[model samples]
Each structure stands twice: as C-alpha cells, then as structure tokens.
Target: MASRKSGKPASAKPAQPTAPKYLDAKRGVANWTQATEWLRVRGIEDIECITPDFAGVARGKMMPSSKFTSNTSLSLPSAVFRHTISGEYPEETGDFRYDPLDGDLKLVPDLSTLSVVPWETDPTAQVICDMVTTKGEPVSYTPRNVLKKVVELYTARGWKPVVAPEIEFYLVAQHEDPDYPLKPPRGRSGRTITGGQSYSIAGVNEFDELVDDIYDFSDKQGLEIDTLIHEEGPAQLEINLRHGDPVELADQVFMFKRTIREAALKHGMYATFMAKPMQQYAGSAMHIHQSVVDAKSGKNVFSKADGEPSEAFFHFIGGMQHYVPRALVMMAPYVNSYRRLTPDMACPVNNAWGYDNRTTAFRVPHSEPVARRVENRLPSSDANSYLALAASLACGYLGMVNGLVPSDPAYKTVNEGSVDLPRGLLEALSLLEGEPAFAEMFGQEFINTYVGVKRGEFETFMQVISPWEREFLLLNV
Candidate 1:
C-alpha cells in the first residue's frame, strides 16, 4: 500500500487487550463483543492509529489495534497541534507539551466514519478522533472543537446549520522519469481529463474504474453523495454530497477526501485537493452550500411562510458579504490558489451574492422553500472542510445575530488594487494579522500557531526557483 505522504500511519493504534467500559458507553459500542463485531464486519485487519487533524495539520497518533477503547490514552507531541506546514509555533518546537516530547493526549474515535476500504481486502480501516487530556479535557485549537463551539451557538438559538460540499480533485498519473515525472496522456494537460466525452456525460467513462470505486465506497460509508460529474477541465471530478446537519456533513467530507485519495491511488493515479494544481486550466473548488433550520420544529429559517425571501436569508448573505474580504484566507488559503480567481476560471472573485449567479462569490441555488440555500463557491479544494464550514457558518451567525445587510450586489466590485488577496503565504499571514475579528474568531493560540507554520512554508518555497522562472528569467537575469 502507498503510505500517506505526510500523515500518521493509517493504522498505528495502541493495543486493545479488551475494550474498556468507558468506550462501550460512549456510543453504539455496547461491549467488547459488539466492538469486535463491528471491526470484523468491516474486515479491518487491525485498527492502528486514531487521531485528530486540525485543518490539514496532523495533531494526533497512529495507535496499535490492541489498545482500541473508549479510554485509550495517547500522547501526541505538542508540536503536532502547531501548524507544521507553516511552522507557526517556533517557541514550542522542542518543548514538552502533549507527550514526553510533548504529553499524553487521549484518543477517542468518531464512529460515524466507520466503513470498509474496497481497495484493501483486509481493508484496515480507521476513524478520526478527538485529542483530550488524561483528565478528559478537550483541545480547544483543534478544528473539531472549534466547530462544536459554533454548533453550540446555533443550538442555543434553536437553529441548526445545514452544510453540504461539492468537492473537486485533480487526478494525475505518476511516472518514474524525474524530468517529466507526471506523464499525463497525450495532449491531456490537466484536471478535466482530456478525451472524447466532455462536460458531465460519457467523458468520465474514461475513468469509470476509479469513479465507480468512489461511488461504492461512499455508499458503504453512508456518505450520501448525490452526484459525481466531470468538471469543465480535464481530469477533474466533482463530487456533490447531500446537505445535512453541519456536523454530519462535515464528517462526510472528512472521510470522503481520505477515501477518494486512497481509492484513486489503487488505479495508478493521485488525487490532490489543492485548490490550484493546473497552471493553465481551471482550478478545483469545494463549494459549500448552506442554510439554517429551526432545531426542533425543523423549519427552514431562511424562508418565510409567505414564500418570499426572508430577512434571515438576506442578513445571512449580508454577513457573508461583509466578512468575505477578511475571511478570504480561509476560503482560498494558499498563495497559488488565488490565481484561480480570474474572471473565467470558474472561480468567483467578486465578494458579492446573487440569485442563481455563479459569477458572485455567494450563489443562491434556485430551489423549493425547503431546499433554498446559499452556496459559497469561493472555497478552494485544498481547504479544511470542517473549518471552512464552521467559519463560514460562524460568519453567517454573526450576520443573523447582528442583522448585517449588504449593499446591493455588484460585479467583482471590490477594487482589486485596494486589497487584493495575498499573492503568497506571507501576504496571507499579513492579511490574517490585520483582521482582528477573524483572528479572534478562531482564537489567539490557534492564530499564533497557524501563522508560525505557514510562514515556514512560505520561506521554504521562496528558496526554491520554479520551472517557470527557470525557463523565463534564469538566462535573461
């Protein structure tokens, strides 16, 4: 099996001699027999590691199966919680925080992610977990914890946020030639999968083997994927999942990306959730479609009984519109990612909303009262699905709670010269530093750690020259 490039081993779990009583009571795990039965049914060879990931950052462990339990205490290094990709925590790099190298952190699985890996006969499956202390205290900076905070706010207001995601990924074939490492088919430059069939039809037939695997795996996991279509660009596939309560949908996305990547690998292909992978074609997006509902009565909060656009909906859009500039980093996090926002790249650069207008950053999908919702099309495929949804809904809450009404819609109206998105990671950190409200939204510790890690990546990328620079400026300069 191809190892995950930068993550913990898929199954590095602690030994589970016997399932602990605490684990049995947590969820549907009634006893050791039930737990093993579940594992057996899925053909999981041995449950290895169960850890938490914070917005693409790995902060947990890869446990051995023998220790699978509700009370399994595992310690992740303190550095795990900090942003490694960006090196956000320079001070905490070698200090003891979470284990001996850091400290002992608790690991508990979220059973909703349980499912078999069709690509693996033994399948060796695992689930995402929460990082807690031996005292059972939750880690606040973790993306899951942050999302729970947002969900609590909605619960208090007797409302629940609905979230669904349309995920896109680029599939490229790997090759041995170092000079031309990724040898795609002839004339097939990137994501859209060049060939005969195009745009949502027989085109995807060329990759049916893996697409079929994706559909089967998603169904087995109860992911509720509504549609999978060929994107406008070659080799790009968009998977549209059904909207559900925020937490459930977030779970689906978390598992779906992991599964899709693993599945794609089985057929000699690689899947990248990076917002921008192709230099000359359209970049991938993770469009989040959202709406809120009355928690108990299950009423559509965005629609009125009279069937007109409700005040709640507009305020929600208004909040989104107002916060987009500050929240741009989260929706489109990477430096290369911003380049995809060109007027015709299928990316909506304008921070505006409209009824059924794809050009606007916020697109209101035309549907019945029950289905009416706003689709935030700005999010990049590389985004942390959980954080993206949480922050977005949080911004919407700010809108509804504060009654933020936006000015009438405009076309890419925000002056590009005034405050353009960060052209690189350093610029993003700079923008993040300036936005007190957004920084405060995720809290101080998280912000500090995130900025540290991203800066490291930015510095690293700067040291290396790109193929473009080599071809254009090396000789001339």
Candidate 2:
C-alpha cells in the first residue's frame, strides 16, 4: 500500500528541482495539451480546479476538459479566502479583506495533484490549485501556500521533513435531527458495537466490509495507507499513513478524509472526523509523527553517529513546546475541537515531552537511529492538514535555527507537573493573537484574517442553544 503512493504521474516528477517551461504560461501551451491528451486517454471529460479554504473545505470551479486545456488561467472570487466554516461571509466585521467589494484571484493548478475521481460516474479529474493575485504573489491565507512557505524554509537549510499522520474517525448511523445524539452504525454482522475494544481483531472484523471498501478506495486513489486498528471508542477506527514529505502527506490526508466520508455515505452510514463525537468515549486525534533529514545524505538528522540524540532533535522538541500553545488555533480549529482537549481525554493538554509517555503532548518514540522521530499528539482529526502541518513544522524549524533547549522530559506523568493549554476556543484564539513568534512566522495579514473569520464562527456558535443547556438550565434559571 505504501509503495502505491509513490506512483505519480510522469508530469509530477522532474529530474530538475525547478518547474519546467511546459508549466510556465509564457513559455508554451504544450504541457496543457499534454495533460489534456493524458486525461482524454483515461476517459476523463471534466476537471475540477480546487483550492482548500481557511476551514480546509474544498472550494473551486469545474470546467470541461476542453476549456481547462485552452484557458491560461482560472479566476475565483478573492472573498472565497475569507468565507467562514458555516459558509457565511464575515461582512459584519468590515475588515477590507472581508468586505463585499472583494475581487478575483487567479487559480494556478498544481498539475502534480491531478487524480481521477473514482466516485464520480462521468469521469472527472481533480487537481489542487494555489491562489495567487494577477500580479503573481501568493494569497497569504491560502492554506497550501502557507504550508509551502514553511517547506521552503527547510529547503533553504538543506533539510527535509517527513511526516506520518494517524487519523481517527467514527462510523455512525445518520440522524436528521440536529439535537439527537449519534449512534454507532450496525456492522455487517448485524451488531452495533457496545463495548470498548482497543486493537481487538474481532472488533475490526465486525465492519470488515466497510473496512475493505475503505482500503479499496484508498488504493484506487493512490493513498499510501499503512495500517488499520480498531480504537477504544465504540465504532471509532484509526488509519495510519506511512511517513513521507510533509506537503505530499498533507495532500494525502486531505483526500483520504473525503474518500472515507463519500464511501460511508454510499454504504448508508456516516463518517465524522469530529474531534469529540461521543461524550463517553475517547476523542479522535490526527497524531503526527515527524522527523527531519539531511537533504543531501537522506539520513535522519535527529540522531548522532554513535546513536545518541542530536542537538537538532532537542531544539526541535523545544520549539514544539514553545510554539504549540500559540499554534492551537490551527491544531484544534473548531468550538467542538476544544471539547476533545480535557485533562483525562487521552489528549495532550500541555507541551510536555516524554519518552513513550502517552500523557505528554510530544513523545519521543523508541526506534532505530535512522528512524528516530517525535510524535506530536496535539492536533485533532478536524484540523486542516495544510495549516496543521505548516504550524508544526514552523515551530520545529524555529527551534532548530535558534538553538533552543527543551525542558526536561516528564518521566512521571501528566499529573505531576505539566502546564495546561488554553481551555476553549476563545482562549486559544486569544493566545494565538498574543504570541509574537506565531505572528512573525505566519505574518500579520494571515493572523488578522484567520482570527476575524474564526471569531465570527465562535460568535455564531454561541448564538445556538444546546440541548444540555435546556435540560440543565431551562427550569432552574
């Protein structure tokens, strides 16, 4: 399965580092022509030029293959960058970026991301695009570009970062009512999960059909899924992707979520990446395993020659501890996201590091020198992969460049002595705004827009009354 992910279209891989003339608009239209021919041979008639928004939702335009091949550029409203999670425009804020007068932004398709839509009957290909102004500057808030900037920072230092993401989600029976609690979907064995079964083979076999189909679709889409394990939650499951380049890994994570959801809908069940879908069960997380390697030698830089830890490794951990609180907005991006970050939720509530200690936010796994890595348990499954990876890598990069030292490992447990992270969305957002390192790393323009948009989401969430409130406070108040 891991080998399948490296099968890229011939166009994606080049002997040289720089993009070829075929991709440049000024050079020639040959690449577009070649791409059109390539799709035509594969029975694809349409192309969707997609860009991930601030909320990590796919947004873009669909065009016929002929138009896509002929057009030199695609135009989408710049306001799409500022749209909130509810699909609402933050017009009330009056920020120039959110104003109604927003105009067009150019969409540059990343030809390398082109993949066939296995779920669509008519044969469509989708490629992720990068948003840029007509003058050619990358849009500050574009999630992919934001990630690319961080990757570039590593490239400049002759280093490469590899990441593997473990994503957890739930399979539930679809319910139409907004107030109703979700129930586990019945498996092919005619039974709904009633007990916690962490790593139970019988538990995984209950939904064997669904699990088989997920693997089938994942392979069809070139996702390099490595392992599947039944989690402690009733119907919750976790999938692990093999470690690879950060940007490529993020793309796979993004596509894998969509594929899982669509496959679930087809089977009359629903899959949610919600951080805390069930009140009684453990929350879901997108735990990331990261390691830095020397670009030239292709060797792990976190380990020394005699198998001792490297200075870079300690600095990386220090950076993560120093910066994770400020990057919480991207790690746990929604109101429900904070619900998963409680003290005993098996979620990391602080920046403490430990050697194989699940209680800490960052854990140094036991591995060979060549495979030494740090596992970040901070991000929820609901996070935008691009932003989350970018923020995580940026923190480690800062630590490496500045030579910061990490605090002593939490050899005991989280209960002994660990600092608590922000307790809620509002608090996390406030922390993000107050952190100077984050503002300087991500830029003020992005910070302001992201805060404004997410603040609106938080405000909108407060307007809705929940069943818990009514049940507990309606008569008492």
Candidate 3:
C-alpha cells in the first residue's frame, strides 16, 4: 500500500495537545451530571456507548449527543459475550448454555473513560461501558468485569496491584486478501524494513509522521505512553504504557489498540497486533510488569522496609510459574498465538523465573526496591487486555494467599527447546479445564464459556487446508 502524504507544511510546528479537563475536575466525572456537563462543554455531536467484547473488539451503539443523557439505557445481546473471534457463536458452550431466546444485557457507562474520539471527522466522544443485568448485577463473564473482580480480591486483602504493559505490533502493507502473507510497509526512505533493528532511532524515524499521529491520538484520549521503541522484527514497534491501576491500565490498552489501528489506516498502512504476523520474523508479545502495594500504607509489598525482596514477591513469582500454564489460554487466546511461543523467536518457551533473564517466562528486573516487579513474558499481543491482566493477577493472588514457594532462580538460559507450555489451543484449554483454581477465582461460568469459545475457534481452524499441506502431502502422500 502506498503511504499518503500529509498536507502540512514541512516547517510548521504542531500544536501542543492538552489533556482532557474532566481528568483534573475532581479526578474525574463522578456522576451523570458531571459527565453531561463535560460533553456539553466539548460541543460533542455523537456518543459511542461501547463495551469491549471477548476479542477486545468495541461493540455498542452510537447515539446523537442530545439523546445521550444520564438516564440513557443501552443494551446488547448477552450472546455477544459468547462470540468467537470470527463473530460466530460456538455450537457447544460447555456447562453455560446460550439461551435460545437471546437476552439483553444493560450497558452501564464508566464516566472516567469518557474521552474525545480524535480520529473521527465529527465531534464524537466514546465511553467504555460495563455490562450488567436488568436487575443491576454485574455480568461476571465480561472481560472488564472479570478484571474488576480480580482487582477487588486484592482490595479486600488491603493490597493494590499495579501493572504496566509493553505491547509489540507490526506495521504491514495493506492487503485485502487473507491467503497472502503480510509484508512490511515502505518507509520514508522508500524501502521495506529488514529484521534486527532493535532500539534503532533511524528505524523509528522512518515512520515519523505515523508515530506522531499515534502520540497525538493517545494524548487526546489521555493515554500516557512511557516509551516507544523499534523491536527485533521487521517494522515491528513496541509501546510501553505507564503503570497504574489494573482496570484503568487495561481500559487504556483496549482503547489504545483502536487508536493505533485508526492512526495506521490514516497513513495507508495496517497496524497488526497479531502474535506472529510474519513467518520469518520475531513474534509480538505483551509483556506485563506487575507489583503489589499496601492499600493503606502505600508501601511496596514486594519489598521490605530495608529494600530487600519480600516473601510476597517470591510467592508472586511462584504463583506465576505454577499457574501461568493453566492460564495460558487466556493470554494466548487464538490458535495462531501458540506459534509465537517457540524458542529463539524472542519469546519465552518455559515458565522459568530468573533475575533479568529474557529467556525465562518470568523475570525480576533490576530496580530499586520501590520499583521492584516481576515481568511476565508469556502473553501474546493479540490477547484481550482485560482478561490477560485478570488471569495474571489472579495467579499471583493465589500464590500470595497460599504461601506458595517458587523453585530456585534459573541461573542458565531455559529456552533451549525445553517447552513447558501446551503446544496448541486445545491442549491449553484442556489444561485450563482441569485447573479448579481458575474456576474458583474467575467464576465457573466464565471458564466454561471461554473454553467453549476457544474450542470452536480451534475446530474452525482445523477445517482449513493450509498451503503447507498441499505443498508436501498433496504430492508425497
């Protein structure tokens, strides 16, 4: 695809964007009154009343600003939660059966998530909604709701968990056909990027205009980006988000994916969050750096007063090492996701933990005690942000509460083809189904539906005959 040139003059300076005023207005809008006033002041014309589905796809309705009020009620079919990535309902949904007469679920707006849709031509605002029953009970299976439930577990224990996500993605040429492989887009130098450009400034500068748009869009939405760097894959870039509350960060990530894709389309390219978009390049990952703190004292629970590693820290690691494989289905949700977990692809092959080791699934980075945290390198970039964060935190919570002990730190590289994780989606789903802990932490109904959705996707994949099958088996067999 050809890149579209912007009409702005080369010497012109871009205007400095300001954060949304509602953010500083008593931390955020607390009620519909405050939310209405904020929208009114912005001269908003349309409101996107939306919620993230299981695939992190924004699903909801758009209403005129005048019709949007504090009392506005929006509903979607409960079947939306049971939808596979292909938008089809699974034939079998485990113990949680889908009702023949699809029911409606209410969408309750979260006022804090209200932000301007900068990419839209019309004055539009979007807000993330939480799904609830007509009786006002939360929909436990919804991804955002699942994360909130896990966070509440920490809150009940007087502990607050914080997470920062480093998400990697690739910019590829626009291709209309699904059968063809993706190719890197042409940059400013009129050349396609080659692999092995990690941390290269010139590599980043090649797509300066698109990168600037990403930053501008993020600023308008109040998404704070800690840093952006080139990764080891061709045209692959990683954006690190500032750490904060789990739910808040997850919301930002869900929104950020939309923002990034829109910005890329504006430049005539496609930004793919696929775990392994290219066959011969590095796979993308969403590496999560997480830690816990005392809710009252605001002290780091992973570190003691003397700046030494706390028992809770080790337990958290132990929990991740023990339970991440069971929860792998949540992090690597798609069949293609497992292709990214192979050794020597800049991906972790085992659940081993070590100090600043990239080969291990869990790594304790070098930091002062206050910033001490464990980095989980298992999740693929294609995962649902809310579910990934919830699964990770739940595992750590189980470790801390159960006083689990981790194996000794891995002193040597653990990625030498010693695969410790399930090799396929079905295998991972089987592991998840056998683990009662996940069902206990995240409701059993959710577990059933999630497993069912994944199984349906895997079955659909099996129906397809790949080029490889025809290339060899067609003649040889």
Per-model TM against the reference: 0.83, 0.91, 0.94
Predictions in order: lDDT: 0.69, 0.84, 0.91
The per-candidate count of clashes, in order, stands at 41, 0, 0
The 10-residue segment of model 3 with minimum total lDDT is 19-28
Q: What is the lDDT of residue 256 in candidate 1?
A: 83
Instruction: Please give, for residues 151-201, the per-residue lDDT of candidate 1 as tens digits.
Output: 888899999998889998878776555445343332222353563233656
Q: Give the alpha carbon lDDT tens digit for every residue of 229-276 in model 3.
A: 999998999999999999999998999999999999999999999999
Where model 2 places Cα greater than 4 Å from the true spot, the runs are 1-33, 91-96, 415-419
Give the number of the best model, judged by lDDT. Answer: 3
Cα lDDT of candidate 2 equals 0.84
